[model samples]
Target: MLCVRKSYALPTIILICLTYFLFANLPPGAESPSVNERTESPDTPDQANDGRLHFTKKSEKYPVSEYIPLPTAAPSPIPQIQYDFPPESWWGRRQRVKRQKAVKEAFTHAWNGYRKHAWMHDELSPLSGDTRETFAGWAATLVDSLDSLVIMGLMDEFEEALKAIEHIDFSTTHATQINIFETNIRYLGGFLGAYDLTNGTYPILLKKATEVADFVYASFDTRNRMPQSRWEWTRSAEGLGIEPSRNTILAELGSLNLEFTRMTQLTKDPKYFDAIQRIADEMEDAQKKTRVPGLWPLFVNAQDMSFPDPRFSVGGMADSAYEYLPKEHMLLGAQTKQYRKMYDAAMDPIKKRLLFRAMTRDGKEVYFPGNIQATLSPGRETLEPQVEHLKCFLGGTVGIGAKVFDRPDELSIARKLTDGCIWGYDIMPTGIMPEIMYISPCKHLESCPWEEKKWYKDVRDRLAKGAQLEDLTGMAKSLIQKHGLPPGVTQIADAQYKLRPEAIESVFIMYRITGDQELQDAAWRMFRNIEKMTRTEFAHAAIDDVRDPHTEQLDYMESFWLAETLKYFYLIFSEPDLVSLDEYVLNTEAHPFRRPTAA
Candidate 1:
């Protein structure tokens, strides 16, 4: 009797559950409304056709109101300089178009070679068709070349590159250590520039950029929040202790603001900006305390954030630090005045102490920024008459700074510095500047003559350290004949041409700022010479010596060859409005970050 009652009850319960479940999730309009419900009118607001409730009306008790805007002053207007750009008759529209096409073809040739041989590597060994993992095997050339592809209207190649970018896991790399400065400028700058240029159409780039920023941000984990310029990521990941170096290179430490600030602008995360701003504040406070009152040394004591080294240069160890000051001011929309103040303070001393005229055989009026050796006394500082191809970037830096800051004197100085670099390329047998060289200095900046007696004296002083007249004379003659060296050029310190972009970088800036057609012609000649010398079956390779026209090709090609060098070359031929200086600020790597409009 109990079993019979249980079975009957179970069947009754099952039938009741089925009936309830069937009615609960019926399709809309399948079931009729309850008797108490009223039909919704078409005019009814906040009513969902799916029968879900929504609160659309504002609450009477807690009314929302407009918020006050943040206070900000409008940025000063950029002075309109009437540039003397070559007219169509002078530049010739057909010739301009033809040059542009040639540049595009060159880029395509190199890019295709990279794709075929070193698609996922840091660099392509153009000579051997091999790949090198110079930067964590991160496909550096691909990321670095993103904006260039967009600028050149190479959408097909850009899309193909995107497929590789999407899979890059920046958090983990084969590289045991990474250069924070290089990573920031090349990868972070490249990502943000591509993102801004595309107007947020590609969110993946920003995602990748954030990943890279986060990865490098770990290097800033210190008591002072100063980053480790050369970060050992493998050790850091393994929970080993890592800290900022006691001695840090100025350019490596200070060149990070531009890229990190841009990251903050796009992501709205202040951590990236704060990390770099702390370094900037440290630099600003220490600016006047250095051995040279206004200039900082090549290396700084990171513990105290002081300039302990007496060597000062606008070259390798210190180039981009000063370059970023005015650019950061521009990037921040000139709202921050410290960068402007820092730039002005630094430039005054740079112009007065570092710049010197080179006594050319042709007596061309040109100037180069030389390194300084600070002494105990301020006036006793000595100048080293060595110029670096890297320092050629100063020409463009000052040119744009002059226009932005409204300094006409600096503009003239900028032209002379640019001409100095062009002279370097022009005099070289391969028509490419050497990595570093020594030159004869002019006593006067404004006026210089080819002092034949002074030239011989310098040669004798340099070569007569321990050698006899025969060896010295033979060495001097060899320097003049074998290298086909120009007058004023004393020695080729590093004769290898590493496919550097600084010379053309300045030329592009000067062209944009002054609209000088002569700069365009100069850049065209430079491009032709570089293409003829460096071009390989796979891609362009660095040469063993610029003094030898048939110089042997080095296996490695730097990522900057495509990123900065070729991009600058391509933009020099492109229309001015494509990446106008007024509309964008470029990082040291030639990645263009769009400037904010004045409030």
Candidate 2:
């Protein structure tokens, strides 16, 4: 398998955002209008307006135009949830481990080029001077290293990386949005994962994670909070007048909240718990303010609260964080319960409407939602923009449907959605999954930057490959019909193979929940495929760029996704698993720094 080289593997790292199907320009001949597809543009942000007058007009003095500014209010306290690791908690143990070691190799390999104070890269490491990807590259490497520390019970190694996380600061001008890398995927998981592994001894990770989370916290037009998106800095506190992406808050506060929630429990610190709850409340506020329950716009502006584009809404890209909903756990306390209610409420539609369940209009069992434009206002759109949040919520609703009031077919519907996503052929040529795919068709490639003409050419030169689309598709469908979607996720469209892994680990969970052999077989195949692609260091799946493919060590380090994929897989295959991962993983915006507080 090809690795992230000395450079890649940090995935969707450095520069991460969304423009779903921007390249495909719509799939081939699948142009039937969707439920919410408007004749006006269905791809960008303005489509939400459709000229209808807003239900409740804003104050005459603060009339809303393109964006709606936020009203200042005192910060509220966090809520409480409770839990204990149940027997079934670690269901996907097998899947998580198989994938973990493979991905760990990728990170270890990437670190070969690790420098002291400067960033490094593969293709462009020598071109001009410093590349933003360089910083993103190193941050991802260090982030992965930190993960090893947590899971391997080596807090000492984690602390070394922690120092870099704390002391190292990038020049905002040269890198622009590149440092946004740390907050992308692995960092959040590693930090919070530290606490989970240490049996709550790693409070520093959570506390420090919060401090670092402030980097991209506000995202609107704020002087600094707004991100350097599309090379454009959100100049004012108004945030380009857009609602922040769901991932944005989730990565920062959401991920941090997970850590703080744990810290609160470990140290019994009300402040940590308070912080997590406050973020959850804000997420709720953001959700209610958005369009339809399922729609998750990519970015929003603050000046007039106008939305930009939800299509690859940077933070809310894939459904990686879908599995973190409230569940019974040994460590989670009242925080789990409170989180469950809000998360359950927010995720309900996703399970029912978005997950690729048998009930889907297209019956293949995949349930990736097309972003909609029903937001009441712009700011709201940015805050809670995840198409699958509904499906995730549904999974939770079904997992405990007895209490949540769901339908009898909840499991059936959820299974189909998950299956369809995994079976969708258009998802990826890698036979794995890309970040995002189209429900319909967007045949043009220029619309998307990453998948543009340049990217495909890069893929063409890959050294090794395995597995065909039919194999994965067949297995996904079979698994779903036999068992069902897991309790916490929606479908991962295999039709296009885009956003493929979003549904990977959860499928293993489904099998664990029901103790079904068919699901295990499906998981076994996924593991085989990943291992088959393993190169000297990491799995081929770990490398995004084929031109520079060569499984490196760093790629494998924080391979949290792999960790999750295999861990879950392992648990399903292994008998009598421990239920919860001693190490909890938060696939969020991984920040090296702690949350902000006055010095």
Candidate 3:
């Protein structure tokens, strides 16, 4: 049976305020259209306006113009030297084919487990053989894995999944509320990605994608048109008023551009694109006003479009928001320039402020991106040395941004960052990167020698400040004797491995961009380690700790384990031209969206 949580009831006072805000803020000529009336725009030519006012009067303030099919400008051609692949003979084409098949087999094992144990649920608990609904009980794993199946040529599985998708009613869900960001990327993005890959041969894919997108689009029906990042569809369905959350994270509100724009492209309804574009406009205005000039804060107030928190990171709370900039530019075939402008603005500070080199025991010069806690005073921001496995995706985002925008220097940084994530995997006991850890950063970007005494002292100081004496002693002993942690790793903040795809995601991008055979070899080692450590009788499971080879297996398996992690692993070994970076731009979820043709 599917899990159903009780809905959150809105406070009466807040509801009254929202009602007045909606009516009072209506533009002079704009009728405050009901949510149902605002759901669809009239069908019209690509460039022609539908002769409707879709937004509040404040919509005129949007920095980006409305949807119009502009003639795509030819992108600057990539230099041939940028792509230096190992010749087919050098890598042995037969061996590559075998590896690709192995990855497919791994995917199939996981998929079959989901089918047998948790078919219509969000995830499979591989160990205990239970079903879990992390998202709405909508077969998230099935929908999320759709494109992966198509990419791997699992036509039989794809057809089976499509049969199930045909019956999914997006209008209602067991869960009272859904994460707007996760739903958009996994379900909506999944449908569109599969549609593109199959060249619309399956109209059901687009039909389903449109259905999911419409459900998502309704969340943007606020006075300001900014979406409630976590939307309560049940309340909206109940005819209770809904408003955007006063507190929301950057990625939640900002990462919808790629998926929403693609929806508009396919349906010729500007409503989807218009909703996200309004977000972009507000973000553009907010970018320069942030404590860090180029970057936006992690937490935002969607109600008034304010940045309440001054913390910034290229990591969790703020990752995909920045990631989508260059991707959105490529998806539009370089027709949109604001995305490029935003990309440049953010990358400048990210290179200087967030990215740092780690001083390793072997004196290897590798870079990792970190976080910043900003103060109102200039030049007083605190740099947090903690890094998340999720941040590893930055390596790929940067590499692709470099290629798309013709920034060669950033590509070099991309290589070092990719290597850093690989080092993270190689250093751990299970040969898989942990969810999060703290590192001793080097003062210099290019070179930093390992100083044993300094590293020990820094670790001791950090432990002494917050830890109990016995706790500090135990941690010190464990760091030296039990954990056998690599130098420069101050602490394993989160030891669990969640079967994340970010590290491999970067490796795949590096291979595609540079044709680096070394990356392929590194990825193979990662896959072997992951398979050995996490494989269960049923399917793969996330482990308790990456530092223990015999760690207990956790019950839950994320959808990305198959949708992204294995998909990237398979593509790394498959033919280079398959899902070519030049042809398609992948969403944060690793679903590949076909790019518009460059003129």
Name the top TM-score candidate.
Answer: 3
Clashes (candidate 3): 0
Candidate 2, residues 461-546, lDDT tens digits: the string is 12112434444445444433332222111332221211123345455445534455555565555555444443332122243421
Q: Cα deviation of 547 in candidate 2 (Å)?
A: 17
Predicted candidate 2, C-alpha RMSD: 16.5
Off by over 4 Å in 3: 1-87, 466-479, 482-484
**How far out, in Å, is residue 495 in model 2?**
10
Q: Which candidate would rank higher by TM-score, 1 or 2?
A: 1
TM-score of each: 0.85, 0.49, 0.87
Candidate 1 lDDT over 1-599, as tens digits, reads: 01222445788776565334222332211222233222222122233464322223221221113322211466656554335455566547777778889888888898999999989888889989989988877889999999999999999998888889987868676555678899999999999888888888989999999989988887776556777677755434533334566678889999998888888778777778878888888999999989887788988777567688989999998999999988988888887678889999999889889999999888899999998889888857878888899999999999878988888878989999999999999998888899998888999997888886566555655545455666555656654665455678877778999999999999999988888889999999999999999999998988888888888988888989888998999888877788888778899999999877874
Model 1 local distance difference test score: 0.80
RMSD of each: 16.9, 16.5, 7.7
Ranking by lDDT: 3, 1, 2
lDDT of 3 by residue, 387-485 (tens): 699999999989988888888888989999999999999999899999998888888887798887666655765444565555555556555554455
lDDT of each: 0.80, 0.36, 0.81
Model 1 residue runs over 4 Å out of place are 1-76, 80-87, 466-475, 482-484
Name the weakest run of 10 consecutive residues (lDDT summed) in model 2: 52-61
